[model samples]
Target: MAQKPLVLILGPAGHTGDSIVEGLLESGNYRVAGLVRPSSLTKPSTEKLRQRGVEIRAGDLKDSMADLKKHLEGVDIVVSCILAMVVLDQKDLIRAAKEVGVKRFIPCDWATPGQRGIRPMGDMKGEIRDFIVDIGLPHTFIDVGWWMQLFLPLPARSKREPEVHARVNTEYAGGTTPTALTDLRTIGRWVARIIADPRTLNHPVLICEDERTQKDAFEIGCRLSGEAESLAAKRISISAEEIESRFIKFKAASEASENPMAWEILYPYWTMAYVKSIYVMGENSIASAKKIGYLDAQALYPDMTRTTLESFAEWFYALEEPAYAHF
Candidate 1:
């Protein structure tokens, strides 16, 4: 296609939402639309999408099939970026889109596709994907890693300097499995490219930039900050016991659906391991624009890119604009 597909990104108003909108608009090829409830529309992020010519549709997954059908009209692509904790009842939008004959769909699976069969989120995506196929709808799961946006504001202990940023090392899948993190800029950029290409439809696409551990992060951070590494840093690992404990903690806190500190604390263990569910994508690969070369997108995308964890910290620091305050 000469131009990218027209897309409607549902729940494009949170941290990742703003970046995705910018990526689409900058391409000068894709027509953008954003799906938001009245609340998201009032948020500052909505204005960013609006300025990019994204039509803000005032509706949500809570809407019935008819209401969803009304909003999805003439939509070639429907991306679910909804911030739903559990998607048990959230399959309404997918069903409605299929009924409306939408060409392509991107599920709100910001996690890794390797997680599809293993993690709770993976099961959720699997259920949705299965139903979509049974009903014969074309879809793609834009499975990305833990977003790079989360690592910023860097532990509040650092030296300010122009040459370097604070270093951040993370290991989500215990210390053995690689922790693949994507820059929000890359996710937004990748989403735009996926919409532009039709070949990616009906396939699962995973994008993660680099892998690094806590030890590596500290080493890099010290170099950037112009200081020798702190000898006190300890390595942390995500074990089954840790994951189980976290699940218990979160479940207890979320009894009334009151998500608080416990939920965030426990999620890294259970959520990451479970979501790291392995599915077929040519032997668990990481893909990115920098490695594959953005122009020749037809080939199999690279599993990982050259962007390291330490360097990503620098990029986030540089984009010190108001709209994307800290991610």
Candidate 2:
């Protein structure tokens, strides 16, 4: 009998990482391992992964190249699902992967697909990607269009009452542009298949289960949650120029402010930039992704079950309060 490939994942306890870990474990095809911070070793989420038989290693992305290489030694594949704030830090990890000659290195690109300059976060991820390509690291880039978790309207008990649901008001330039949406739970399934497939080597893949305009998604949520009136009232629209203007303003503020918490102000606008790219620039759809040389995940895996927006909304509304709020 052949030995299973060893797959090491960074950020296995995170929202997206957790899903990916679950998918890999469910597939039962590889030896799963995670590199978690030493401080988080005792956390429930980390413990859960340990209980599931995952080989947990204590290390940080900011660790020295020698240390990272040690952690990556003998790993066949490395999948990074780390947070966006620290995406640029992946350079060291990439160097380590290259040094160790891992079979595959999957970067942390679990968001909408777009070119550089369209989104700040995208640019950060792009920097790591450029470094990977420049150094000739065998890799795959995966982007799941906007999360379905953020597609629905906030559930409300009554129109006259205050909003109690955890949903936030999403401001975008347009509502008619079609944007791809993917359930967070299903991302890992797509990733699992992509990593295992030889065709995805050194290619970018877009994982989109459902595509709908913002208006259409809200209507679906309204229909499912019985909060048409309330949801409709919460729709906030902004012009493209306004989005760009605010992005500039907040970005300047974030750069100029001396306070350490300056990111708090710029974070929303950074997110707004992403929203503008998807809803107004139309960069989140499969068409856009393909235009930029991304492999269509749906076409690649026809056997995989997709969680549609309507179905996700139905399941989302039924919950008293969803524990996983990506928005």
Candidate 3:
């Protein structure tokens, strides 16, 4: 309940990590501690964090507690948002958070699909969460919903328009609806508010804007394409069973070690969490997804207005970010 501590965010230089830090810093709600690898000190985001006056500490995530404790000295919370495909060593960081006196720690989990549908994600994040709780470390599992920008139409390299090409044929669990998706751009700031509020505690808060849904994506995409006649422009209905089946198939393909399909493993969930959640229940379920215990980000930041998928899509390609230079 007390204001968030001079929080330390492990891996604060990465995409999701930087967004979280920016939100916290910009809110003027908490000071940020940036834990990054010595090699990454020169990273664009790390340099930017330093310029913004965040306490940036360089350390190896794989190092022993003695090596990482320095960064944790005065830290209240740890927010980690590393890319999984590239980074493998998070246990040391988790152990260090426990060994040190960090009050609450937020994990890198960004996909906030419905509770029932995210079983696979939990399977991925389960051990880390349990380990933290077992060590008596207060941990917050923040599931930011799907990254909608990745949805839209597929690239020229990939022929099928996601709208036209059906990646997952499964419908919703109840066999009455198709899975829904959310705009992930809305997630970063929601995470900031969650970490800022004491009531969020150390719980899994599924972060999504109030208007999050698969329909949002369909409507917006249709509008953007100027294809009112396109089926995606109009609301379509499928069963929950179909959605669940599609997700399960998608997950099985993702878990396939023999030939891991990259997009199947990562982007589908990012594109469908909201749709899954919508089928499971509805907008009311977003609170349970975020694990507010009894609070919501909107209530916490009364002045906050979440960006809709349509607005985010327009701005997504417009950001003049230095990290990514489109050739």
Cα-based TM-score, every candidate: 0.72, 0.92, 0.70
lDDT of each model, Cα atoms only? Answer: 0.60, 0.84, 0.60
* Candidate 3 Cα outliers beyond 4 Å, as residue runs: 1-4, 85-88, 113-119, 151-186, 225-295, 299-302, 313-327
- Worst-scoring 10-residue span by lDDT in model 3: 318-327
Measure candidate 3: CA RMSD: 5.8
List, residue by residue over 1-327, the lDDT tens digit for candidate 2.
987888999999988998999889888888899999999999999899999989999999999989999999789999998987789888988888998899999999999998788687888888888999999999999999988887766766423223324234454676678889999988888888999999999999999999988778777877888878876777777778887787777767766778624568757658667866887788999999999999999999999999888889888888777434643
Give the per-residue lDDT digits (tens) of candidate 3, residues 162-261.
4443432223343333322345434556777787667778766655554444545555545654444643433345676666666676666666745554
C-alpha lDDT (0 to 100) for residue 3 of candidate 1: 53
Residue 318 error, candidate 3, Å: 6.8
Candidate 3, lDDT over the whole model = 0.60
* Candidate 1 segments whose C-alpha is farther than 4 A from its true place: 1-4, 115-117, 151-155, 158-176, 226-231, 234-269, 272-306, 316-327
Candidate 1 per-residue lDDT, tens place, 1-327, comes to 455567888777765666677777776777788888876678877787677688888987889899999999878888777774645555788888888999987777776444333455566767877777778888876766656555433432434331123212333344343445677766777777776566677766666666544445555544553334442242334554555565556545544454433555446534434433321122123433233222222234453244567787666445433124331
Predicted structure 1: lDDT: 0.60
